[model samples]
Target: MSASIPQDVFSAEWLALREELDARSRSHRLTGLAVDWLDKRSAGAPYGIVDLGCGSGSNLGFLASRLPGPQRWRLVDHDAQLLVHARRRGALLRDRAGSRVALETHCRSLSPMDRELLADADLVVASALFDLMSRSWVESLVAACAGHGQALLLTLSVDGDWAFLDRHGARVEESEDIAVRTLFQTHQHRDKGLGPALGGEGPAVLASILLAAGFWVESDATPWHLTAGDATQRGLAEALVTGWHDAAIEETPTQAARLGAWRDRRLADIDAGELGVTVGHRDLFAWPAERG
Candidate 1:
C-alpha cells in the first residue's frame, strides 16, 4: 500500500477536491454535539485544540471557522511539506464571528507522542484519520483523552459502503466494481505507520474503545453524496475513481485488465455527467461520561 501510494497523497489539488464534499458530508448533528461539548468544556475561556494527522490544515481552516471565540491549535502530522501548507492556511483562517486564532505546527507522528501533547487541549480531533489507525493506537488515543478530560471529534472515516448511481438513479451493478472495492478495502487495512489499520470498521471500533474507556460517544453517518453537475463534485468523483482503480489494481494484479475496463467506464460516466457516487463515512464525538 505504501509503495503504491503517491508521494503527495494529500496534495493541494486532492485536498481541494474533497474539502467542500467533506464540509457537506460531515454530520452536522454530530458537530452540534461537539460544539455543545466544546462550549461546556471551554466555559467562556480560550479553547485549545490538538489536531492529529492534520494534513494540509483543511480541518484547521474548517473547524476554526465554525468553532467560536479565541482558539489555539496545534496541528500535528508527519509530513513536513503538509505541515508547512497547514501552517500557512491555518494563519489565514477567518470566521464569521471574527474569532481570533493562534496556530502551531508539529512535524511528528501522533502515535509516539506523550499524553502531554493533549494535556492542555480542550479538544482533540482528526479528519479522515482514524481509519488509518490500529486498535492499539486508537486505544492509546482514547486513554489519553479520557485521562486528560479532553473532548474528542473524529470525522470522515470510510465504512466499506460505496455505490454508484446511474442516470435512472438505479445502483450501478458491475462485478468488477465489487471485486475492486473489496480489494481496495483490503489494502486500506494494511499498516499505515500505525499498525494494521481498522479500514471500514473504524467508527465502530473507535466507539467501542471510547465507550469501554468510560467516555460517552456519539456518531453519525457522513456519506459523500457526489453529483457530476458541480465542478468540484466532478473533480472529486474523477479523483476518487482513479484512486480506487489504482489501489484495486495494485492489490489484485490478476484483475488489472478487468479493473482497468471498469475504471474506463466510470471515467466515461463522469465525463458524460451521469455518475452519482456515494462513499460512506462516519463522524464521531466523545466526552467523558461524567463531565465535571
Candidate 2:
C-alpha cells in the first residue's frame, strides 16, 4: 500500500465532481437507506445523527430532507470549507421545512484524536468514505462507535468491481487501470493517508465488522448506474478509470504505451457516446453494541 494518500481521497477532483452533481439535484439511494435504518430503529425513540466526513453537504441535505428528527445533528468533517457548505445546508433545511432542527458541526479529519465524535453521536454516519480506509483504522472506528453505543451506517462503498452491459470492459486484466485499484488499495494500510481499506471486501466486509463489534448489521446494495445524460456521472467515471490507469503506469512504466492505448479507446468511446457506464454501490446499517 502506498503511504502517501492525501487526507481527502482524490483531493480536488472528487469534491469538484460532487459539486457538479449536486447542482444537478443528485441524491444517492443510500440516503433513503439511512432513513429506513432509523425508522426501523426508532423503536419509539428519538436518535441523533452525526454525519461523519460530511463533504460539501451533499448527503446532509438529503438527510435533513428525509429524517426530520428533532434529535441532534452533528456534521463532522476535517475540511473546513466543506463544513461551511454543511452549515449552509443546515440553514437551507431550516428555511425549507421551517423546522428547528438542532445542528452542530465539527471540523476535523477522521482520526483517533477526535474522541468527541464517539462520545457524542448516537449514530455515526458516513457515506462513500469507508472504502478509502484501511483495516486498522476501520477497526478503531468501529470500536469507537461500539463504545459509544452509536449505530454505524456507512453507505455507497465500492466493492472492487464495476459493471456495464459489457462485463468484459469492466475487468481490466491487461490494462493499466488494474494498477490504479492496487495503488489506492495499497493506501488503505499504508497509514500516512486515508488509513486502511475499511470496505474493499465490499458489503460483506462491513457486515463482518459491524457484527463482530456487536451490532446486527443489515445491508442493501444500490446499483448506482449512470447513463449518458448525467454529465457529472460520466465525468467521474472517466476520472476514476483514467486515474487508475495513470497510477498503474506511474508504478510500472513498462505497460505505459499499451495502457495509454486502452485509455484512449475507452475515453474515445465515451466521447463518441458509444459506451455505457454504470456504477454499483451498497449501504450498510448496524446498531450500537448495546442496542443489538
Candidate 3:
C-alpha cells in the first residue's frame, strides 16, 4: 500500500471485499437522479466525470452502465497499484447506450484541492471517500463544482452510526461496546492524509455545503446490513470488529485490554452466528439549483 492511501482501506483486498456490498447499499433513487441530471446536459459530446479516490474503479463499474452513454471518466487515486486495477476494470465498462467508455487514471494525492482537475468535468463522483476528508476540503470541492456548474454524486459516506444486532434484528449493546465505539469514532477524526477527517459527519457536512452553494441536493440512507449467516458478510463483520478494536486501542491505549476483550466477544458472536452488523452510510446527488 502507498503511504498516501488512507487507513490502508484502498488496498485491492479491502476494495474487493466491500465492492459488492457498496453496490447493493447505494441508493438507487439518488443514482437515478444523477443519471437524469447528467442526461439533461448538452448531448453533442460525451459527459465528463471525475471519480475521486477511485479505488479499483468500483464507482465507475457501478455507475457506468447506469448513466448515459459516450462517457469519459478520470479515475484519481494516490496508489499507483490500485490505479492499475481501476484502469483494467474500467476498460471493460460500457454506458447505458452500450458504447465503450473513455477512461484515464491519475495517481496523485487529492489534498491542496486541484481546481484544474474539475475544469473539464461535467460531474464529480466519489464513493466511500468523503469521511476521510476534512470540512475545508469538502467545501473547496463543492465550490469548484459549483463554479463549473457540475453535478455531484457521492455515495457510502459513513454517517457515524453502527451496531451489533441479534439474528432477530434487535440491538445488542454492552458498556464496553459503547466505549469502544466512542473511541473508534474519535479515531476516525484523526488525520488520514487529509487533515482532520470528518468521519461519520462527512455526509451531513457535505450536504449542508452543497445546499449552501445553491445546489439542489437529494440524499438517502445507504447503510450496510450484514448477516452472520452469509459467509462473505460474516468475514466483513469480523474485519469490522478487528478494525474497530484496533482503532479504539490506537485512540485510547489505556483501554487496550478492555477493547481486546470486547473484540474477542464480537468475534465469538460472529462465529456462533448470533450477531450481525449494520453500518450507516448516506448517498447524495446534487446539481445546480437552476437545473432543478
Candidate 4:
C-alpha cells in the first residue's frame, strides 16, 4: 500500500453506505460462508478471531456464538460510530456467554493501530473487503500475517465480470454493454481505490495471491441474484450500480451519455419486471500450519 492509499473510504459517509447497502443479517449470503470458514479452520483449539472492518458488529459477535470452546473475539473498524454499535453488541454477547470469549473492540484504521493485534491473530478475516482494496495492500497484509503464522480468510470478492445470457445479452448491441461495463469498472477502481482489478474478478485474483503466499486456498461460492423489480434487492443494486456509474464517468466524460442510457435501460428492465444481476462471491482460504 502506498502513502496515497485512499484510506478515507471508511469515513462517515462510506460507513453509512455500508449500513444501507449491505443486506440485513447485516450481510445476506456471506455470513454463513464466513462462519463455516472460521469454524472448520479453528481445529480443536480455542478460536482466536478478529472481525476487521466489522460494521456495527452485526456478524462479529454472532460468528463467535457459533463456535464452541474458548473463543477470543475482537471487533475492529475505522468507523467510530460503527464501533459504538459493535461495543454494544459485544456487551450483549458478554452477557449471554458470560464473557467466555474476551470480547474486545479497537476503533482505528487498520493502517496503523491494528498491525500489532494482527501480528498476534490466529485467523484474520474479512467479508467484502478485499474487493475494495488494492493489490499492494492485500499482498502486504497477507505477507505480514503469514510471517506471523496467522491464516487469512477473505470472502465476497466482486468478480466484476457479469453474465447476462444470450437473450438479454443480444439486447445490448451498439456500443452495448461494453461501454457501461468499462465505465462502471473505471468508476469502481477510482472511487474505491481497488486499483486495476476487474471489480467482480477480485476473488480469483485474491486466490492466486493466497496460493503464491503458500496458503492453501479453498474456494467456495454463493450467488446473490437481484431482480430490480423487487424493491429490496432493486434498491441495493441501484445504489451500487449508480455509484459505480458515477465513478466511471468521473474519469471519462465520453461515457456520460452511454452511462445514462445503460442505467435507464437497466432501470426499465427492472421496472418492467425483468431486470436481473448476479452479485458473485467466493470464499475459503487457509494458511496451513508450517511443518517442522
On TM-score, the leading prediction is 3
Best by lDDT: 3
Write down the lDDT of every candidate, Cα atoms only: 0.78, 0.60, 0.86, 0.57
Model 3 regions lying over 4 Å from their true place: 1-7
Encode model 3's per-residue lDDT on 1-292: one tens digit a residue.
1111135587798788778888899999998998888877889788999999897889999999999978999888999998999899988889999999999888899997899888788899999888899999999999999999999999899887778888887787878888877877888888988899898889889989999999998999998888756676887788788888888888888978878888998899898888999888899999999767
TM-score rank order? 3, 1, 2, 4
Instruction: Please report how far candidate 1 places residue 81 from its true position, in Å.
Output: 2.0
RMSD of 3: 2.2
Over the stretch 1-292, how does candidate 2's per-residue lDDT look in tens digits?
A: 1012224353544765644433233334445545655666644334577787787766666566666465567888877877887787677674123565677888877765355676655667776776656666677777777777777767666565553333333423433444545654543333345554453564667778778878877676654454544454667667655765665566558877877887787776666555545545567777754555
In model 2, pairs of residues that clash are: 1-186, 78-108, 78-109, 133-196, 133-197, 134-195, 134-196, 134-197, 188-196
- Which whole-number lDDT from 0 to 100 does residue 7 have in model 2? 41
Residue pairs of candidate 3 with colliding backbone atoms: none
Q: Write down the lDDT that model 1 would get.
A: 0.78
Candidate 1 TM-score, true structure as reference: 0.92
True lDDT of residue 137, candidate 4: 68
